[model samples]
Target: MNFKNFGSQKYLLSEKMSGFSSLAHCFTTREGGFSTGKIQGLNLGFRVGDTPEDVTKNYRQVCDDMGFSFDNMVLSRQEHTDNIRIVTEEDKGKGLTKESDIFETDGLITNLKNVPLGIFYADCVPVLLYDREKQVIGAIHSGWRGTVMGISAKAVEIFKEKFGSEVKDIVCAIGPCIGPCCFEVQEDVAQHFDSEYVLKKENGRFNIDLWKANVDILASAGVPRENIDIAEECTKCKNQIYYSYRAHGKEHTGRMCAFIELKD
Candidate 1:
């Protein structure tokens, strides 16, 4: 992930998809915001204990840096499930008002211009989808459970099933998250994934590779391997630039958002 420094706010972008003009997307970091202490900067998760005013300020800062209206964002209340919502103009500002109580999905997609879709994640994987030929975009929150359920692949499937988008025409960016280096797992969880990529040990513990598993899932669903850009940054190991619920124990931590929208 390439850190984009735009004076007041800093965010991350994929180098591979930098040339896609119609796609406006970003993976926000824990920098350049008004909050203090645990929720230091750019925390988008309202349920993370940050004051509503501070959360609003953080949202505005990120949107201002990206040149998108904060009011146009459709935020999803991620449940770590495979539920993916198809967002429209009517869903705008769902997270900022009464509609905020209505979002129950872990993923969001839209073909509408100026309507940004956002998914919040701390240590969970953030996936961005863009269908160049169909002008469709999707944002997904895939944690270990979601990955086990193949939510990344399911998001692509939902896009194609609903919008008639070709999986080959979609470019995916797997944003920064808890990398395998720090994402140690138990044997029970390891049993849920394919052993081809997961490494088992004599101690009965496992070093599960969630990234490869999701990539494989996407490929199986027809997304080319070369079209996926995986961010090398690991959230658990790089807590200075990210908030890790696992690394931080039960401490109140902020969230990073993966946002995408079709440019008008």
Candidate 2:
């Protein structure tokens, strides 16, 4: 994944899927928006204690850069579960306009044109799915629990079941997260993973590679390995470029968005 700064908006694109002439998608960074202080730039998570007005303005700035409408954007509440919602026109602006309408899903999928779908993340992996065959797109938030539970794979499964999409035709991107070098976990993480990739540091902490976990989910969902791209940048390791909740540790932190829509 390469971080791209297009003036007021910074985003990440999958290198493997960069040249594919299909779905429009991006994994945003905390570099280009109107919020200040803890929620400094491009903070799209509306209910993270940031002012609603600031979040709205931030969306406006990001949408302006992405060429989408702010009021029409759709978002997920993200419960760290594998639940994925299929959004439609009726769901537009639910999360932003009606702050009370809490969305309880971790992923959103839609084929509707002009309906921008977004998910938020600080240290968690953001996964974007695009089906060139069905012209549908999906965005998912994969925290450690979500990754181990195969939430990314579930999102693709939904796309396949709902849109008749084949896994081979889907291109997936795993964006920047707390990389293995910095994502030290407890024994609970070891209990969750079924792989040999888990490493135990001399300090009695375990490290799990979420990027590999997500890519494995994609592969299990039938997405070809060649079609998947993982951002090599680690959020915790590169705190200056992106926010890291783990590094900040209760310090107010901003969040980035993973967004996509069917281009009209």
Candidate 3:
């Protein structure tokens, strides 16, 4: 991942995805927006108790920085399920300029041009998928629950089923999230993953590596290892740059937006 500065706004771009000329993707940081106080900086989440007006301005700021119109963005209403929605041009501006028609969708896929798929995150993993051959793109919000449900693999299935996208033609980028170094979980959470991905720490706690788990899931779904890029950024460790729900709590933390679009 590489840092990109557009005036006061800062975002991360995947080096692998940057080679594609027909795509626009970014993982935003907590910088350059109209939000204030606890939700200061770029708070892109509408349901996180931030003022709707502030969020609207934040969207405009990020859109301006990314050179895309806020009106063409479709935001996900994440429910941590493996549910995937295939968006179209008609779904543009949902959950942004208007109320979202889609709900309980943790992942979104689209072959539509110029309609950006947006997913909010603080600590959860952000996975972006693009099929060069099919001109399809996807954005996923995978928390531990979503990862356990194999939402990343589900997106790959959608790409294949809906657009005839071959797994070999797809490129994936896993963005920043709560890393295994800081994501300690109880037995219930740890039970779903394999022992190889879980680190048994002291006091019956386990550190679950969502990054590697998702990578394995994608690989199982047929995406090549050489085509995947893991940002390896821990939200808890870098709480100052990215929001960390564990570090700052829900009341004090704001959400970042991981967005991707298939250019016209």
Candidate 4:
């Protein structure tokens, strides 16, 4: 991950995706925004008790820093399902300047230039996809439910079906989220994952590796392993730099955004 800052606001760009000049992407950190009090610093989530005005200001700062207009950015509602929406020129400003018509979508994809796809997360894995050859991009919010449902892998298929993109031409970046180190689950939740990715502890609890689980899903879908980049930062472990729903509780925690746009 490439750490960058514009004034007090800090963000990250994936090492693999940053090499391309055809796209602009950012994974925002919880720093430098108009938000204050309980949910301080770059709180992009409008539903998390933050004012729409403050959230818009936060989005504007990030859009300006990335050299794209916030008006052209499109965001998902993210209901923890595997639903991925293929955005177009008409979808621009859907969840921002305009009232959102999108419903229960966990992912957003687009081939349109200057139309940035955005997804918000606290600890849920945020996956950004780019088809360098086809000029297509995707942003997915893969929480444990979405992961088990194979949203990341489904995204690879979306690239092929929607934009004539080859699996080999698509690259993915899995951003920071709650890691196995702190993500303890019970038998009900642990039963959903493959045993190869689960660690059963002596206390009868389990630790599931969401990062590796997502990697396997993408690779299984034929996205080249070498084309994937994992941030490997655990939001729970590094709560100072990012928000963690488990650490701060959902009501008090803010969300970080994974946003991408095909350069116009």
User: What is the C-alpha lDDT profile of model 2 across 136-198, one tens digit per residue?
Assistant: 889999999898889888888788788999988898888889998988888977779865658
**TM-scores for candidates 1 onward, in order:** 0.95, 0.94, 0.98, 0.98
Q: Counting only residues 3 or more apart in sequence or on different chains, how many pairs clash (N, Cα, C under 3 Å) in candidate 3?
A: 0
| Candidate 2 TM-score over all chains jointly | 0.94
TM-score of 3: 0.98
Candidate 4 segments whose C-alpha is farther than 4 A from its true place: none
Q: Which stretches of candidate 3 lie over 4 Å from their true place?
A: none
List the global CA lDDT of all models. Answer: 0.83, 0.81, 0.90, 0.90
Query: Quick one: RMSD of model 3?
Result: 1.0
- Candidate 1 residue spans exceeding 4 A from truth: none
Candidate 3 backbone collisions, by pair: none
What is candidate 3's local distance difference test score? 0.90
lDDT of 3 by residue, 1-264 (tens): 899998888899999899777989999999788889887888998888899999888888888777665787898788888899999778888888877888999998999888888988999999999998999999999999999989999999989988999999999999999998999999999999999999998788999999899899999999999999999999999998888999999898899988998887
Assess the local accuracy of residue 39 in candidate 1 as a C-alpha lDDT between 0 and 100.
71
Model 2 poorest 10 in a row by lDDT: 94-103
Q: Per lDDT, what order, best first?
A: 4, 3, 1, 2
Candidates sorted by TM-score, descending order?
4, 3, 1, 2
